[model samples]
Target: MKLSKPLIIGIAGGSGSGKTSVTNSIYEVFKEHSVVVIEQDFYYKDQSHLDFEERLLTNYDHPLAFDNKLLISHLRKLLVRQSVEKPIYDYTLHTRSEKSVLIEPKDVIILEGILVLEDEALRNLMDIKLFVDTDADLRIIRRILRDINERGRSIESVVEQYLSVVRPMHNQFIEPTKRYADIIIPEGGHNEVAIDLMVTKIKTILENGTELYYDDDINQ
Candidate 1:
């Protein structure tokens, strides 16, 4: 059944938190239906004007690093059931790629990012907000491995960046947004009980089109 309005779920967490795992869990359950995952990292500001060295100096974990105005516009279009050409970010170049992927409107839109809930406008657009609460040690370890293996970063560089930027930014920006979340998911995707309950809630909304409510128990 088609929803009267698409359900927008905002999943936010620290860089190494299992936000992707949580997003993928939800998407896998609804893959047969109309659902799409939009990553906030895909909206990083274009740095073509800057030289390679200058681009490398970018504080990626900061909120100002994103082109949220364009992201918000695109999200608005999707909310109206219009297609949008979503930007693709290039990690190697530290800027947005020229290529973009066209995304059609879906019944459920999962907006996942390190700071998806940081902006008031972005948070206002979400029907449900989730904060994945993973310990700092685990997060850093995961980040180091992911960056070295997937993003082609050196272990020394990853640790340096995490200590200098990621940790401070998380404390100042990302962690505070937890107060705005409808649910606080500890251990992220590893928490099977939370994921199962979240899936059930989404299915209920899709089937009934009922008003969404924040469950205090879910956060406990």
Candidate 2:
């Protein structure tokens, strides 16, 4: 069944804070339904014009690093059930790829990113705003492992980048957006109770065709 209006869920947190884990949990619960995930990483600004060294200078954790204007525009089209050619970013090249993926509109859209809720325009588009509150130590550990194993980065570089960019950016931008969230999930995906509650809430909206405001006391 098609929804009268798409449900947009914004999941935000610090780098390696289990935002992807939380997103996967929600997507798994509604996979049979018309659901799609839009990653903020895909919207990183193109650095093709810059030299390799200049691209290396990019502070990725900062809000300015994202191509939010393009992201916002694409999201608006999806909200109206229009398909968009989503940009693809190449991590190895430190810039956007030449190709784009065509994304059809869905009943549910999960916007996952470190800075998803940082911008007012983006936050306003979300039906449910979530902040995954994971500890610094755990996040750093996760970041180190993912960068080393998946991105082929050295542990030293990962640690240095986290210390010089990620940690400070989280404090200055990401953490403050928690105040705007409808639900603050502690321990990220490890918080089963919170994830269940969130799933239930989404199901209710889908079934009843109405918006339900979550109680502040239920945030764990």
Candidate whose lDDT is highest: 1
Worst 10 residues of 2 by lDDT: 211-220
Candidate 1 residue 159 C-alpha distance from true site, Å: 1.1
Model 1 residue 152 CA deviation in Å: 1.4
Top TM-score prediction, candidate number: 1
Query: In model 1, where is the ten-residue run with the lowest total lDDT?
Result: 211-220
Would you list the C-alpha lDDT of every candidate in the order shown? Answer: 0.90, 0.89
Off by over 4 Å in 2: 1-3, 210-220
Q: Please provide, for model 2 over 87-182, each residue's C-alpha lDDT reduced to its tens digit, 9 standing for 90 to 100.
A: 898887789999999999988899999999999989977899999999999999998888888877898889888888888999999999999899
lDDT of 2 at 189: 85
Error of 2 at 175 (Å): 0.9
- The CA lDDT at 11 in model 2 is 98
